[model samples]
Target: MMRRYFQCLADRDAPAALRLCTELVEAGRSPVDVLLDVVAPAQHEVGRRWAAGEWTVAHEHAATAISESVAIALGARIPQPDPARGHVVLACAEREWHGLPARLVGFALQEAGWRTTFLGASTPPTQFARFLDDADADAVAISCSVAAALPAARRMIDASRETGLPVLVGGGAFGRDDTRAKALGATAWAPDARAAVRALESIAPPPAGPSVNRRAGIDEHAELVLRFAEFRDSARRRWAAVIGEDAATPLADDALDHALHSLSAALLTDDSRLLREADEWLSELYSARGGPSCAVPALWSALRAVVGEPLPEASRHLGLLRQVGRSAPRLI
Candidate 1:
């Protein structure tokens, strides 16, 4: 099964991966085996290839699309228990397109027996709140792939709380920093879906990790996003100073690109060519500097998530999506 998955990756065949996965399941492979062994491994390999420049951004995106479809198929086969694994609605802020990690979390929870309701990438806050009420989910989880998306993630969690749903934070936005998670009033920081189940063991417990990602206010999300970015930049600068660009070259060329791309995929579109270009950026930084990439495909997904792309009149409401965070009153 694992070999079949690798074959798909080497061939850059998303559809082939899905077909092979289905066949393996019929052959009695456990869904868990498919995910832990086949699905996750193939995705990781694709990432490895992209970082090494063996694969282009386009190739990576195709691979992710195929892998996600297989995950969905495998998830469907999991015997969903009654009451629906405590309904979980997964999404990212309107400006955030990193949905792969969130999907992984969603799938993990779904397979763990949660009735997962995935809103996919670039979900508008207005709709996100509505989904919570409509789905009457037990909890709402937001994934942020970059610091820029932190403001949006904070708002989604805040709005999700109006209905009194427990808001959970995951993804790169919270990766190098958990304090932002606390400051945003996130009930918990799950890191990933598997961790989410543990994080949500009950209602938001007394934030056990750092205690800054949560707070009380309206625009607080935006303030946190700014602070998050400032902090990330500062941390990065300090690290650069200490390591000196020359010494960090290898890591910049390899690992950092992979990490940043991972950050982008969770923060940007899964199929984003822009995220893969993070490697190009890394190449420049390392020339001598380095960077990183997933998610489901959405029509106008990247445009909706990032700035610069002008939307058609029909998508004007898409701007409302960012309003959720922009409207959030900042904390002192």
Candidate 2:
């Protein structure tokens, strides 16, 4: 069934994908099972294929659109339990464009009897705060899928806590655990929708208290952010000079932006693991694409060179990454 569903996604057959899910539910499979078991794993496979260069970005996007349609259809088919549980509002972190994960959580919460409102992708902090003013929500759940969005996640958590609401954060950005979530002062962290429901069950509205403060390194992060464009352009030019203009494609540009964002996120959290994870992922991705072994190192070297003298902290972080790259096992 899963293999057939993957073919439907690969073929961009929305109707077939929806039909497959519908058939599963009609066959006495729970909608939640079909979603978490079938649709979610299918999406993960989609990502794997894309990262392995077996599918184009267009293919991934098209498949994701079909998956979203299927999720919505499956959600609508779910017989709503009476809204006995309190309301929960779910939003993706600002600048975090991945909304499907959050949407899945919302559906799971709804099935579990919580009243859920999903404010789709890339929800800004100010706008999210305004929504809470009228929402009367019991708790806020923020979803983030990338390290780049950690700062925004912190702001969203702050917004929720300011309203005396405990925030439940989940998704890839927090790593495999709640350490980063704790660093950001989130009320709780759950790894997935199932865990999120359980975590929220344990949390209640907190008493009025001082607002959660942003962590240290804000100043250095700000400095890096201010010069990001300068750093990006310098890295691009240097990379082009060394690797040829033809090699500096938009994908390469995205790699540079991702690196810088990961770096900034690392600096913000005082965690080198964040950057290392990003580095390892990029290295594996390049390796999978049959990119030259030198590609990742060259890009990092260019970034390190252009980070310049004014930002010693950023340079130091890059220097550490350089050492790691040297000693780390190379992908074959």
Candidate 3:
């Protein structure tokens, strides 16, 4: 069933995908089961294919649109449940544009008997807080997919807590464990929607207390944010010099921006693993695209050079990444 649905996605056949799901539901499968078992895994494959360069970005987007449509369609077919489990508001972190995961969580919660309101993608902290003002929500759930959005997740957590609501955080940004979630002062962390449902079953509003201080290297992160444009200009120039190009292509420029964002996230979290993982992913992406082997190294060098004296911590992190790069098997 997964393979057939994936083919439907690959073929961009939304109707076929919806029919497949409908067929499953008619066969006595739960709508939520179809969603979790079929749609969710298919979407994961979409990401995997995109990362492996097996599908173009446009192809991935089209497939994702189909999957989202299927999820929404399945959601409507779910028999309305009592809001007996209390209300939960779900949102994606600011600058975190991927909302599908959060949407899945919202639907999963609905299936689990919780009334939910999904705020969609890129919700600002102030905006989130404003909504909570009139909302009778029992708790808030935040989903973030990238490390760069961790700071925004932290801000959202703060906003939820300010209203005496505990924040339940999940998604790729929090890693495979609660380390980052706890670091950001989230009330609880769940790896996925099922885990989230279980976590919320035991969740309570946090006690009134002072906020956790997770800003050990925040000054460097702030510096990166403050001088981002200047650093970009410098990195661009350095990249051209090292790569023997007059200017970077749009894709290369986007990669550079992502690299810098990862650096900023590393500094903000005081975790070098973020940078290491990013470097590894980019290396794989570049290799898959048949890009030059030096591209990733040159990117790191350019970022390192631009980092210079002002951001010693970021520089140190980049140095660690470079070491990892050297020791790892050459992707290209």
Candidate 4:
């Protein structure tokens, strides 16, 4: 049944997919089960396929829109119980535009009999804090889809903590085998919506420590950040020189920005594994966007030459890009 629903989504048949879910509910399947078991898996697969270059961004976006609609429909079908447990605020980190994970968690919270305020995507910290000021929330659940948004997440987490709100952090940004949330001062971490719901049920707020700037704490990372800023300016000027004058297009700009963002995020953890993984994913994403693989090699080499010996990860990443360039489509 889930596979059938996924097919409906891939076919862009929102109505049919909704109908299938409606029938599942009519047949005594719990709405929450359908959400967790059906909608969630389908959305995950959609993301995976997109990353694997099996589907275009348009197809992924269409499927996600339909899934968001389905989540709303399911929320309507499921009765919201009184706030017997507690009131919770759900939001994605600032600039983290993917909200489906937060949405699903909101629905799950509602099912668990908690009053939830879902702030949706790209919720600014000040704006979210303002909202929290007026509302009575026991906990805040922050969803971040990208590692690049962790700085924003840290800001939100700090703001929430100022109000004595216990924060539960979860998302793909943390990657596997990492404690990014706790490292950022979160009360607890939840890897998924189900775990988020459970975490909210029973989580003790940790003792607050003096707020620290995560980026400025590490000497090497701080230096790298400064070097990257200078390198970015040089790369822009030299882009036309290396890739041709026509190579300074938006696609090229986006690829460079992506590389910088990923590398910066990886700097936070100083994890070599994460740096390599991020570059691998970025290479795949760049290719998926029809970005020339040559751009990856070009950008990495430029950064290496400009930044000097400070960032060794750039060398490792450049190796990956060179391998990618070997088999990728030629520049147009």
Candidate 1 lDDT, 90-127, residue by residue in tens:
88777676566677777777667788778888888887
**lDDT by candidate, in order shown:** 0.57, 0.83, 0.84, 0.75
Using alpha carbons, what is the TM-score of model 3? Answer: 0.93
Candidate 2 C-alpha lDDT tens digits along 120-194: 999999999999999989999999999889899988888888888998999888888878787777888998889
Ranking of all candidate structures by their TM-score, best first: 3, 2, 4, 1
Candidate 3 residue lDDT tens string, 1-332: 99999999999999999999999999999888888889989999999899888999999999989988988988997656764678899999999988888998988899889889999999998998899999999999999988778888888898888899989999887777887677677889999889999999987887676445646367888888899999999988888886666236765776788889888877766677777777878778778877777777788888887785788888888877645645244221
Tell me the tens digit of each residue's lDDT in model 4 across 1-332.
88999999989999999999989999999888899899999999999898777888899999999999998998898676763588889999987999998989888888888888899999998898899898888889999878668778878888888888888888888666436676677888887878878888788765776444454324544565677667687766665567675457776676666666666665555444444555567667767877765665566666556544656554444344445534223211
What's the TM-score of every candidate structure? 0.61, 0.91, 0.93, 0.82
Candidate 2 — what's its lDDT? 0.83
- Please report how far candidate 1 places residue 28 from its true position, in Å: 4.1
Residue 203 Cα positional deviation in candidate 1, in Å, after optimal superposition: 3.1
Rank by lDDT (best first)? 3, 2, 4, 1
Candidate 1 local distance difference test against the native = 0.57
Stretches off by above 4 angstroms in model 3 are: 207-214, 323-332
Q: Which pairs of residues have clashing backbones in candidate 4?
A: none
Which runs in model 4 stand beyond 4 Å of their true positions? 52-54, 211-229, 236-251, 269-273, 286-298, 308-332
Best by TM-score: 3
Lowest lDDT 10-residue stretch of candidate 3: 323-332
Give the Å error, residue 110, model 3.
1.2
What lDDT does candidate 1 reach at residue 135?
A: 88
Cα TM-score of candidate 4? 0.82
